[model samples]
Target chain A: MNRFGFFILFIIIIFSSKKLYSKNIKVCSTCEFKSLEMAIESSCNYDSIIVEKGIYKEFNIIISKPLTIFGKGTPTIDGNYRGEIFEITSENVTIEGFNIINVGESFKNDNAAIRIKNSKNVTIKNNFFENIFFGIYLEKSSFCKIYNNSVTGKATEELYSGNGIHLWHCKNILIENNIIKNVRDGIYLEFSNQCNVINNISQNNLRYGLHFMFSNDDTYRKNNFQNNGSGVAVMFSRNIEMLDNVFQENWGSASYGLLIKEINDSKITNNVFLKNTLGVNMEGSNRISFKGNDFIKNGWAIRVRGASYSNSIVKNNFINNTFDISYNGNINKNLLHKNYWSKYNGYDINKDGIGDLPHRPVSLFSYVVNKSPGAILLIRSLFALILDFSERAYPIFTPTYLIDNEPSINKSE
Target chain B: MIKILSYCFYDITRGYWISIYLSFYLFLGFGLLFLNNDISSAIITLMNIVIYLVPFISLIFGLTYYYSSREFTELLLVQPLKRKTIVLGQFLGVSICLSLSLVFGLSIPFFLVGAYNIENIFDLFVLIVLGCFLTFIFTSISYIISIMNDNKIRGLGYSILIWLFLSVIYDGFLMSFLIYFEQYPLEKISLAFVLLNPIDLARTLMILNLDISALLGYTGALYKIYFGTFNGIIVSSIILFIWLLAPVILMLRIFKKKDF
Candidate 1:
């Protein structure tokens, strides 16, 4: 009976210590605070500083205190063309609903709308940024949540340009639901790890809509990348999960909906690629699963170049392309499986989604293009049509294994 | 007046300072080559001499040819020589000197490159000749401008406008036409337009040399049919000659009647 009583007391002590781990306080203008930092510095612990709706022409507000800074009704934080606004070095700080504008542009120093440097457990949400170079720059920071922010820039020349949300050397960051446009890149992730980017609309950027290099174990979902110079370039990274994203209308001689170069072990699933010059241009990418995505009405649906191996295109839709798939080399290592193709003339008798006959995606015209670019002019010609039909009938020049045995008939329906 | 025009020709042709312009051309060509990552060495060398140097030298010589003629016109009008003979002499003198300098600038490097049995050597020569021809066309254009407009800025503006038309805006306009009539047989349309612009002719020639000329769609086909085969080269040369000679003849006719 005495031992049982001791166990109950131990449980009670553990619960009480967990309760004592945090404290919440509110700071208003009437509550002995003119400036944000003054209120923050004087606050006791874990304060929620409710800033009033006024233009705070503040430069470099360093939040050392653990606080949640919520601005009421889109309070403007003007940097006054001086420097960075909030230089955060504290943990568990949440700054939300503030309109940050006119961040100072410099070539020497990396200035931002909100500079999160070496901070952990940070949440930056529902904020609007204008004329910002690097909006919500996370440098050597970890476990941060940056969501629901609109970041924009009007940079004409490429020299004095930066990303909207720049993540550098950080880990376990969640960036979601942001509308970023007219910057160099909407979200530029470099040397980062274990990040989540979801539901972001990134458009009309100079370089890439979403660009990441050497960043691994990241998942980006439900993001719309449209009308960018180069849609989205994922380079030199591995183990990425990109799901339900729309990459569209990135048209140029070298532009693509998504350019996955030198990447490995990535999964691109349930995404929509439309009207790009080349949709999903894969170069030096290996062990990537491209499944359940829709490649609709692109110039070329898929382009594989140079030694890309062990990649799978499964359960995707390839609809109405000039060429469905273009491969430079005959050494086939990529697999196409169970994809719905509009041009698939196969019978599906078993009442299943999979077709009975194999769909040959790589055409002889595509092979001719690989050798001679001028052959594309013969595309609409009757002679070229006969040549393509003859090649398709024999199946000699194209790669033998590039066939989807199980092709779905009615995808859009 | 004829003697003075001959001196102007000699001043332009014998000048050692013209090498500065050649160096600038080489530098610009080299810069363009370096910027393009996948451009082959053969193509780079071809473009360096053909596109960059030939056009620039031709333009410089042609402009100098026209400017010298304009300067000579002031003296020629006050002299005892007939207006037609003075104009004819000045034109002959300028054309001879300008053509010589252009050929010299182009052929020296080309002969060295072609000695190695390079495949594009013949096309390079053709492009250079075309460049000289383009200069002749522009020179004739400038003569008309110099007669009609007295302001140097106006003349310069007209030259720049013409340059923009040939180089950049012409392509944009062609693209719009192609896009609008996409359902039609674009090959014939492009062929018609190719006759109108010498730059387009040069561009077609260059693109045909590239393996990816097929990527240019219907316009590429027009080029292929007209410039792709062995017989096509002869046809292109003839077309270029027509373009070059037609403009010069028109300018001379206009200059003959106009009160300067």
Candidate 2:
């Protein structure tokens, strides 16, 4: 009976102590924990800080513990253009259902709405960021998930604006379903590896919708990039898979749907490039595979510039672009096969879907325009057409081996 | 002038040649629509044929009609009509007949294809207007050529050469100029050269109206800034009008002092 009494006391003491720690700390204007900073300071590890629906006019709120910063009904954290709002310096942090706004703009430093530094397994979900210089910056972080967040900036110039989601030395990050716009580069990934950027709409930015530098083994699929200064630019990257993205209406003299420089062994498949000034401007890229893409109404589709070698361009639909392919050099080390060109007027006498004769994607007019851009004024002129026809009869100025061997008669759906 | 214009108009309208021209356009329009099936793309294809073929046909047809009607012209000269009225009337009559044929022929197929609801209706209207301008300009030039040289074969050769120069050879020289002086800034000079050639001017006008001007890159952007606005369009239209007026006035002046 004495032993049973001792056991009952032990169970009661354990339950009371467990409830004393790891409890919900509610913060509001009327609550005992009035401010978010006080609540975060007083709360122990593994505690949940519930912020109610009110505008918390505060900045520089640093969370250095493993805490769940939960919002009751999307509480507003107004930085008032002061500084960074929430800096997560701890691991296993999950901050959701918050409206973070008015992040301070700085030229020397990137002041983000939420800056995560040296963190692991941080999940930033369902947050709305506005008027921010930088949004959701991850520095030297890994295993972060930024999902369903809309990061918008009111930036007018490149020098003052920062990226919507900036990842530096990040790994295994998942960025999905985010609507990012009006920043310098919508999603700037530098030295970030094994990142999956999917289902994001990045449009109308001051610069490229997405920019990658020195990143490898990254995959960005099903993203919509439109009407920016340019579309996505991947430079000095390798093993990148850009699949099922829609790039549209990115038109300017120097704009491109996808610009790759010094990139090697990338696979770009099933993407739609529509109405861009130059779709796929490749320079010094090697062993890249372009398959099942639709190039529609672009200025110059796939301008293979200096030293782009061993590229297999196959199964893509070239529909009514001003120039199907523009090559700078005379050497042709790339392979183009089984592509449907709308300007192909050859016959299929063998009852097969492929044409009997090859389709030359590059014309002498494009070659001339490449040599002298002023010659583009004579496009669609009678002289240019006759020149293109005669050059086809004898391959003189254009790249001779840049021909689609099995040109498809019908467009692939 | 109105009586002379009416007589010339009715006479050309009754000719089998006008009907053949109308039927040829009808066949081309229908065949292009049937092949493309997309109204917007059909308009693009029509643009290619119309830019070159329209001027070619207008030039040759005006020369042939004038050469064949020399006796009729002499007969009209013996009447109480003035040379200015006769020259202007014949020019208006031939241009109007060819313009009507082009408009009606292309419009039927487009309307039947339900292109009235397409947003490219404005482009089609621009096309018809440009076609009329080409006809008027080429016909007046042909009239001036016929009046200058009394020999029919010489007149034919000169008119053909003029068409060839404006449509093809002028661009050849411009291209050579562009290639030879590629290091120089050729924007202003190319725009000036395009303004000089009526065929290239019409092509630039129509291409700028379409969204494909983005493909033209820097020169296209410069052209868009100069010719894609309301003021620029007005200036281009005025330029095309001057091209028409200069030849017509010259033809009238040459006929006024002719030794025939």
Candidate 3:
């Protein structure tokens, strides 16, 4: 043996003694392996199973160890057109570029296209889920990044359906850049904390585009919720920031662009509300800062009721709403400052951008809805004419404190 | 008749009729109840029932009327009865069937939930009936649409389009106007808009019943002074009647002009 052969022997020995080893396994739908579940079950550590591009009918593939499953060009793992396809129970798992579909609907079971239960640091990306019940559900999971995935479901009713991306009891999750449509909820967070949802488009969901319930310390930015039935609702949550999101085309008598209930210490800024029945319906919400929002072409810009205290509505553009602001209670603890009122006829003095006089937004018609239920028809009559003028003159029927003191002369971004 | 009855029965009894609405209404009722514990669940439940029942009954009945007019037209037209009788019969049949279903689905569950007193439930029952009447009003219009168009898809599409326009777009336009005229007195404008859309009137009725009208604010105050009493219910009924009557009469007039 020469010096060169001895050197090659030494290198091979060192490489073989490494901590981890990987193997690539190719599985096709036509293969005798029969299912993706079989292929996954048979795989081991440091294994990369590349699934072929076909609809492989399988269900409930549980991965209990570290693995990397890569699908080549959107290989679909359908639940035989029936149930949950993948349930991950391990840490350090990656499921990339797969189409998971037809998750089962059952009251007895919680089915998902990909359910990550009790897992951490799991990365699921670039997957497509079509007509699934629960797409990418994470229950009791933490520190997961679900990125660049699209989940679509046709949920007619709320009973037999689930959300596009549901995170329950999850924390420190980053769900970014996903497009979801026609599900019960596009993105749902329940009892979830510290999640970041960025740059997602959720449209036409049956119930809500994005629903957060008891989910605290979350920030959702640059998401578009359009034409959903009830729009987006953030309820029973606190310490949240919803920035630069567009909530539009959610129009129904009971619907609103954003419904905030029982929320405190949150910031809703730079949001666009268009063509919604109610732009923002705040109930029992306190200390919320709504700034620099654009309320365009909505029925009611802000409908405040019950314990909605100390909310600051500042630098918002109230453009083209039937009612700029409606306040039911006598107590107007909320503050409206420097908002651009399209209806404001007051002149700007001192070369400042603020209006010379405060804009009193509460209309007498809202007062009629409170005092008498039958006077809505007289809306067209001259009687409504005199009453509104009298109220505006006296400023008595409407809440005295519900005044936008520093209304902006021009709209702000 | 039996075939139609069977189809309607199957649609209703198979749990398909109210599932969509039930899910939403129940969720809304429970959610609101839990969120605002001070506000009675009865209020939420009543509002949910009214909101869900009115539109759903209208849509389903409208579609069913359209379907029957399209599907069994040959027999319907060739019958010995006048076109008015045939149209009215079909309209009433659908209305009755759907009203029955709404009553069964909502009233029984409402009683079970123990949300309201007998008087309020009775009042709700009357409101649901009125809602059914509103559904038939639209159904008759859909029937006219069916008669005018040879294509079922076009007819259905037109109905849905009109529904969307009235339900979504109209309110948006009104809101836009309100925002533009924010400095002006908008109480009268909102009331006028509500009168134009019977759904708005229906919603007002339900909300006032639940005492949630305060949520609408100063605009709501304008309405409350004018239309926020028991007399408002009477006005809503009148408006709903006009909404039902006008389209149906127009449909009847147009039906005579239609080739079918």
Candidate 4:
């Protein structure tokens, strides 16, 4: 044989041998290898360990080998409130169908149910996490998929509770079909990019439902966030697509269905914000498209703070809200058009399905409320109504330029 | 009081204008519900009607009823009944009849639309309560105005003016005052003004129940601290009851010493 032919034969032999040597290890009470730690210690790389349904009282189980650990049934891995559980450091590791519980919370250490550090091509699927400080903490991990998991925490306060599905410096992560509740944040992404968070139901969280900070180029769609402290906050992020999410019933003194702060070049479309304190509380956010959203029965539908510029708010329905749009500044750089305001009293004389008169959404009462929140006691009073009427009749005390020129005559369904 | 109330209710129910008023409300409630196709939006439209039109119609109707029943009132005054009993009975009769008209007109359509479910029943109940309060308060005001002025035209003019001032002009003055003193903290002062006007007080109470106090923002928080609680409801209800009672008492005092 020639030298090139010999080299090709050698490469084929090595690849086949590696697959042939890979074996499956079974760990159960009746088996010789009864414990997970003993099975991992005795196993080689690319070995699969099948653990049976039983309570394993263990903590700090570090996986450094590229192995697949599958539970025959969902075996409980109780940390017993000691420390971290399942600290993964190897690539191509799969931990599936495990019930992880009682992760110890520490102020100094960030304890998690499953902490993945510098791992790639990891799949953590079909897991149940309870009483965890941080569930599924991914640090500097890439190409990870955390799918079909349920994380429920008894988080009372923000300081003590960590996030469910916390990602830091992760890339190309797929977080899908997870039910997360009562955590500080349902899903928190910081400095993580190019991730897809899809079809998650995040409800009753202590703080934000979905929080994004400094993360860019992420797509979050079809998520339901209900009754959270402050629904979703996308702050200091750019080039994000948040579509088809339902943010509902997040009502409080300073709660928002979607709080957009300093985010730019994002598309927030087809979202429904119902009965929040503020539908979308935006500050310094620019160059965004807020279209096809429904703002229903909120305190202030869209409260745009000062310095937000060049955003397009079009084709949305503002139904039964106390105030449609409230701005604190005089410089109107945003475009408000074709939105159906339920309070628009203008007539459609031209028969074009659009009102001839522009609808001024920022009421004088809202402006005053923005200045002195205490003045809200006068809301719906005859005095406040008169003030709103006069401000609408005469373009004074409100930003005159901030008017929807093409207001819809009928409510947009 | 029961006999007198029954007679007055039957008489008012037979009046052509009361029937017109009932049809007007029924038409408005059905029209707004059909046009909006949502209970919340329909309630909002009805709230505007209740706030503005209810007091106006009640004031006008109460003043006219008192003047038109002048002979009947004089006949009752000559009977064995006390002046207080006669005046109280007639006032209750007018207020209750007007309240029933409003309740039947507005709530019948709400019931037809199946809106008396768990969620919206409270809202509908609050609306009925507010209508009753406005009827009681404004009818008493009109009764006082009618008793004070013997001339029918002057009494009618005064009643209209009082309704206009309470519904429109008082708010104008309050707005001007708030604008004039925009620098100072106006929370307490604004709350005081709200309590002083029965219409404003009723609006505040309704808005509080509507859960739009969050829109009030900071002022909403303050009001919530007051009106969002059960104690707040009791306090505001007492104030509204006082508004309902004071003018009636004054009218009774004036009727007792009148030279009629």
Number of the top DockQ candidate: 2
Poorest stretch of ten by lDDT in candidate 2 chain B: B110-119
Interface root-mean-square deviation, each candidate: 12.9, 1.5, 12.5, 2.9
TM-score of chain A of each: 0.88, 0.94, 0.92, 0.94
List the candidate 3 regions with Cα displacement exceeding 4 Å: A1-20, A29-34, A370-386, B1-260
- Residue A39's lDDT within candidate 4 is 94
Query: Largest lDDT belongs to which candidate?
Result: 2
Is candidate 1 or 3 superior in TM-score? 3
lDDT of each: 0.75, 0.90, 0.75, 0.87
Model 4: lDDT equals 0.87
- Local accuracy of candidate 1 as per-residue lDDT tens digits, A1-64: 6999999999999878755764444445555576776777776557567888887788888988
Give the TM-score of each candidate: 0.60, 0.91, 0.61, 0.90
Decreasing DockQ order of the candidates: 2, 4, 1, 3
Please list, in the order the candidates appear, how each scores on TM-score for chain B only. 0.76, 0.96, 0.76, 0.95
Compute the lDDT of residue A107 as modeled in candidate 4.
Answer: 79
Clashing pairs in 4: A373-B218, A373-B219, A374-B219, A376-B219
Which residue pairs of candidate 2 clash? none
Q: Between prediction 3 and prediction 4, which has the larger TM-score? A: 4
